[model samples]
Target: MTTTATAGADAVVVGAGHNGLVAANLLADAGWDILVLEATQAPGGAVRSAEVTAPGYLSDLYSSFYPLGYASPVLRGLDLDRYGLTWTHAPDVLAHLLPDGRAAVVNRDVDTTAASLEAFAPGDGDRWRHAYADWREVAEPMLDTITTPFPPVRGGLTLLRRLRVSGALRLARRLVVPVRKLGDELFDGDGGPALLAGCALHTDLSPEEAGSGVYGWLLAMLGQQVGWPVPVGGSQKITDALVARLVARGGRIDYGARVDRVLTARGRAMGVRTVGGATWRARRAVLADIPAPALFLDLVGAAALPPRLVEDLAHFKWDGSTLKVDWALSAPVPWKNRAVAAAGTVHLGADLDGLTTYSAALARGEVPRDPFLLVGQMSVADPSHSPPGTESLWSYTHLPFRRHWRAEEIAGHVERMEEVLEEAAPGFRSLIVGRHVAGPADLEQGDPSLVGGAVGGGTAAAYQQLFLRPIPGLGRADTPVDRLFLASSSAHPGGGVHGAPGANAARAALARDRALTGELYAGVIGAAHRAVYR
Candidate 1:
């Protein structure tokens, strides 16, 4: 109800998550006045850290490792290290522990990782090395292609030049292959295959799902190249560094200012009104860094959206809900296999078939009795996470999306998860000095963007990726409403710590400011939207 006329900025970012912050910083760097509105009390949306389990123990609230963040050119180009962001890594990147004593570890050293794989099956080490080498050939251009705007202009052109005709077709075919198939085709043993499948689980995709192979291969290779680094102090260090960089560039942030509605005039976004009745106007553009459903249905309103968009939204599938447990351990986890202790991340409770069964259970809307867990050994990765000789640990598992979660179910799932961990590491429960549990509702309460505890914005399934992301429309940041952009994980290139969505939104906004070509480009984009949405 209160309009602050003087509180006008060239651009207004609707959320202070990493994507929103990244967008704001890029806009600020261009000498534009930027104002970021965050619903939470802090900037980091899910990329936050706190001592939830006990004092002197730091735990990553949502996301911990940063392979994507490190490999992202948009983030790397910012040089956040100068702003106090220090990355630390463990001896190994990740480990996949099977029910048996065997462990598949991905080490920073490719030869070491190969050797581990070779143990599972003969000549598997050489096969892994070959796959890694093939990855190296297209890694740079592929990374560029995925993180840049849709159509990938420069990155795509460069990739075509690097791998002409047959090579390009081969890579394209591999990208669409199922993770299960990729593993079977590439590795002779369960070791390398299990490692890739576990990495693929990082997304909502099952090992049997199409497009899961790309995620598995990409993440596993990134682990080899970047070692799944984490901030020295906590995940908050990354947020602090980004905030510092944005602030130094004259950008401003307003926390606890939940934007309820995006104000529009003549079909263009002009500002946003917060829940507290304060209106903040945007002189040029408004970029929404929240989830697609929330931005389209709640803030923008269904009446304002096209009927087709609304219909498509009705069919929009969220990834999956989650259940997480954090523990402040009195001592390190007593793993039966000592190799797992050297890695920052550990995947447990599933093999390839088990992973398929888990995914199937989710599709059936039933919680799997045996959930596959993605666990983080914080203290192992960074010694500063807890008191000397102690450990800070956390694990999360995906569940089927539901309207509500009962407390009893949450507790039951937590127990099941711990039992899995206990089996892998005997006496693990005895080491827990304190513990914290976050169910689907608990996670959503902390961050609204994590709707139903779906972390990756939306499902990473083949039917919902690339040009089909969010909906059947242009894969660019521009929206149906002029001057409004989707800068969230729901956009093209999908989710990760990478700042592609935000960077693409910023670039789109900047393109609209050019003198002569700007108007023409807008007309063309506007036409395209009408054709698609109609």
Candidate 2:
């Protein structure tokens, strides 16, 4: 049943997710012949959209907002707007609502955001302005360091020069501090703390975690700087643009071609074999836009890997599973706090203690009685998402990971989530004309890379970040096997649709393929792999 192709391209990219498309595009730009193979019929992995709720109601299936995408140097360099990608934003960025009806809102306008924070507690406005000013000083270099390849020598030096050693160390300490502690240190009263805690929960990180402060500070600042914007039509438009750019560069993508085996000979990736028994060789390299576990254990097989690598992978951790519900509504949500209506993204949790309790329950493997929800009103952000006068809405909450979620269990959880929503916006459940729910299994089934509905590739824990990400090795895209690179969120700089992982992979592949330095590149990478893996 297996068929073999006579011709092989310079490189074979194992998935057509945004990361793979990005890697393929960069390689194609380098003038290398590239072929990308995808398991699903669609190009976008989780960055997709559909009308699952009702006709004329468009819902973003997985990720909807894109503050990171808008600011990403990798995405910006591509200039995807030329390929029919248009971005639009809601009037306000995000609002965090409390049960008492007090809300802390973040807007692109600094004055508006400062005034909103000041309403909850006096003098917080000046504190916010001070924080924003501090952020502006290190913003460019900080962002650059994050998006570049690991051991970001160039970016690190620039940042160090800007802040000096003592100042840099102080900033590092602030970032590593717990979100709860950081908020307590930086602001007075509950308003500022609630906003930071809500933003930290964007990842699986609890406010109590060591590295949680970074995510909280980074996202809240980005919300102010860029505003969380969405593609004009849908999230799928982002994917479509990446695809169009790749095709324009003569890169090829084969949908429905599931790569099951990475063919290796003499410890180098030679080609890949698909599930349907087709063999496609890679003349130069093979890049995988799949999870680390899938690439090392499932596709390559354990027998071919080093004992240390196999052991390291065993310690890898995935983030929490999630439950997402989409609703097609007859009218906009009637929020008790009218200001919430103006925002594209809303975070609904009573307060800091409520968030702590919810996160603690998830840590203990129990579904919290009160769920902290991240809600999106697509119609508010883009009118085309729904019919006139109606709304397209969706919200997602994290759950303990499970392979299977019973229908009744899902229904019960959905009911609990809706109850929380109704608390903030009275009569929220009444407007639903149609609804669709996706549990962990549904997300994985739609895109296998989203293992257990762990959207951020893996846990963004301090122990698993930077050089230690995916596994302890050179933090670059190079893998144990020569001519192979990890081009997925599982690599360093994990997750977000920034395409850094793919960009890093493409650069590595291109460097190894260079005529003069090819042998030297292989020698250095091989030594590093042996030192760590052997």
Candidate 3:
């Protein structure tokens, strides 16, 4: 490893993931001299792409879709397009393959999507339209509440004004309902319910779990509003654009620099020491864009944290592990149902019942015999993903957290996934020119933040969500230690590439420095917390 003399920066950010880069960019934009240190040689964390399967095929190693990234309020202001970022979308956002040779397709147009569902059950089309109309009424406020700081006073007020007592109460009830229950209540057909249930599986939540309805509803609505998009060229384009913007603003990133410890003095973070024995001092703040456990236990040390916080960390639950496979396809997936061909994403596991069973198996610490899958047809979404006339396909399935799989077991899982694909898209296996597999252990090896390969930061269960995420308290980005912040997906608004946690952390850091704007923002957030909780 390369070593350099100790240097000082106004703000030191550990990790070069999208969130870390976002924090650095925001601080640097405010004229703070920013320094970012990443343990890996490359940035983007899970949002990365490479020719993993074949030289000509670009495969997203982790995250493929970017509905949240596209809709992020923090990212929208960045004007990433100016830095060479382009988005590509498929004709349809997603499709759920049913057992009866039919598909529940989600189109960007609500009418078209509802029409697709209407085929299965009469009147379901109108029901779908009604649900979307309701979503549209509060979409702006809902997005604002989620993407903004915790408590979301302004967002809450906006929502309250738009939705009076009765409406707000109804919406809140809907959010808390289990996906299975919500689907059963709203739609009579398996098509509509299956689509919603499949969306719930995007997180670790089962269809029967409370609070999962929100996940399903949010993704399904977002698909209609913004259609799942991918960065043109490859996901690396997102990282490249972010890096370009940061560099243009006079920020610097030091790759292959692993932070060993956070240097603190008198209960205030002052700097950080790297594994290379080189120390970089921070004059203002130290922001860690790593998981909470790693930041508190490894870098800052559990001894530095309060005993209660340490104890709370011990009980923090991880979502679940994952098994991802990327394939360089000789041709597009030969779907048994042609309607699924135009979709960028496809969900497999027959119906809601299969999904419920899959989730139950995961809860029992056993791999489901019929695992649910989230498949991405990269070339359909972005032609740049593969060579001419070819395709790049990827699929991922959830696994029990911390479960160890032997080589044979891993192989069996892979075979089972292929069989599931075959069931949905005949001849899908024959089209695979090359393939790459990343088991839970492999994912953790690539990015330590994906602890136990549990993506989405941690469980978004009702008990662990919102204010209780990572730990119980107001979900502010600030930590107990002064001038220190947690800017990872482990923070509020949970996961996805939204960059809210990073932006929130930067705002908190700025507030500590007595910046007037930051102070006012923090004040509003605090007031909102009081109003909501009290």
Whole-structure CA lDDT of model 3: 0.88
Give candidate 2 misplaced runs (Cα > 4 Å): 1-3
TM-score of each: 0.99, 0.99, 0.96
Candidate 3 residue-wise lDDT, 1-534, digit = tens: 775658789999999989999999999989999999999898888888999998899999888889988998888888999999999999999999976778999999888999999998999999999889988999889988988778789888998899999988998998899999999998998888998889988999999899999999999989989999999988888889999999999999999999999988877899999997898999999999999888988999877766777778888888899999999999889988899999999998658888888899999999889888899999999999998888999999999998466877778999999999998888888898899999988888888788878887888898877788778767878776668889999989888988898998898888878755655744565555445433
For residues 82-152, write the lDDT of model 1, one tens digit per residue: 99999999889999998777899999999999999999999999999999989898889999999988888
lDDT of 3 at 401: 93
* Model 1, TM vs. native: 0.99
Clashes of each: 0, 0, 0
The TM-score, computed over Cα atoms with residue i paired to residue i, of candidate 2 is 0.99
- Regions of model 3 farther than 4 Å from truth: 1-5, 515-534
lDDT of each: 0.91, 0.91, 0.88
